[model samples]
Target chain A: MQDLVKKMATELDLKGEVCPYTFVKTKLKLEELESGEELVVTFDHAPAVENVPRSLKNEGHKIMGIEQKGDHLWKVRIRKA
Target chain B: MKLGILLTTSPENENTNTVIAISTAARKAGHEVSIFLMYDGVYNVNKKDFAELVDKGVNIAVCALNVEQRKVGRVEGILFGSQYDHACIAADVDRFISFG
Candidate 1:
């Protein structure tokens, strides 16, 4: 079971950031990772939950999962593609 | 992807925000991004956010004629070019986005 746990290459906490900046920072962080590496991004802005994933998908990245951590807070796991 | 952004509007317009957002995103994606500031867009040379864009590796050029007309003098770290430079940037990039 331990071996099955996927390791995250990096984490980006964009709690106070807004739309385009959130996505922009995420993309920049992703660029620093190797292919197949995973990035964990946390968002406090509601729109980023939808916008970030969509924008990443458009760029051909793979979204592993998205989970709500608290009220109006979400985390998205993405695999570089 | 190599992207060319042709900006003809000034910071007074919301289009300037769009340009910054798009250019930032493109640069973050490791894409080559170039911005040609023409007409009123040359006025954005002094904007604080414009400096951030330059720091992020977005190549920015201002039109010589427009800069002189506006008396913007010399802004550090920004290239001053002519229409020919804009044409060359358009020809060199894979796609050109115009914001007027």
Candidate 2:
């Protein structure tokens, strides 16, 4: 059950990416997933964590949460709506 | 629908305030707003309203070359971009209004 739940998400490493593009790429990636699929995105650019999630949410997607990976790194989990 | 607002005038004029007002309203109405500041409009980046718009999830982009030429301080949250950014904003938006 744990393995199955973990496998539900597809990870995208957008480390070092910045805003607009970060939101853009995330939008594109979300389009590739089926409805209700999860995308775990890693981001180094701080604003993308805030910007991307809001942008996605505005586009009708669900933002799961944001977790700090390092001093400045962040991971955003999103579910397609 | 997404709205693209182009502001080419300086902050000393009415364009800055107008852009802020329109962008705020559009964002509040659940529309995506992208502001591309060019020419003398680079100074708008220093405006407090721009920060407020960014906080409201608005996309504000300033012209990099204009900022460099005019010696404007870069605002952290806003996108520092070029004509390409303007083109992208113009293309992606459903409706575009200019304050030029």
Candidates, DockQ:
0.01, 0.04
lDDT of each: 0.82, 0.82
Q: What is the lDDT of candidate 1?
A: 0.82
Real contacts recovered, all predictions: 0.00, 0.00
lDDT of 1 by residue, B1-100 (tens): 9999999988999988999999998888999999999889999988899756888999888776577678886577777755545766888899998999
Would candidate 2 be rated incorrect, acceptable, medium or high by CAPRI criteria? Answer: incorrect
Interface RMSD of each: 14.8, 6.3
TM-score (0 to 1) of chain B, per candidate? 0.95, 0.96
**DockQ of candidate 2 against the true complex:** 0.04
Off by over 4 Å in 1: A1-81
Model 2 misses residue A38 by how many Å? 0.5
Instruction: Encode model 2's per-residue lDDT on A30-74: one tens digit a residue.
Output: 889999889999998765675577667767899888999899899
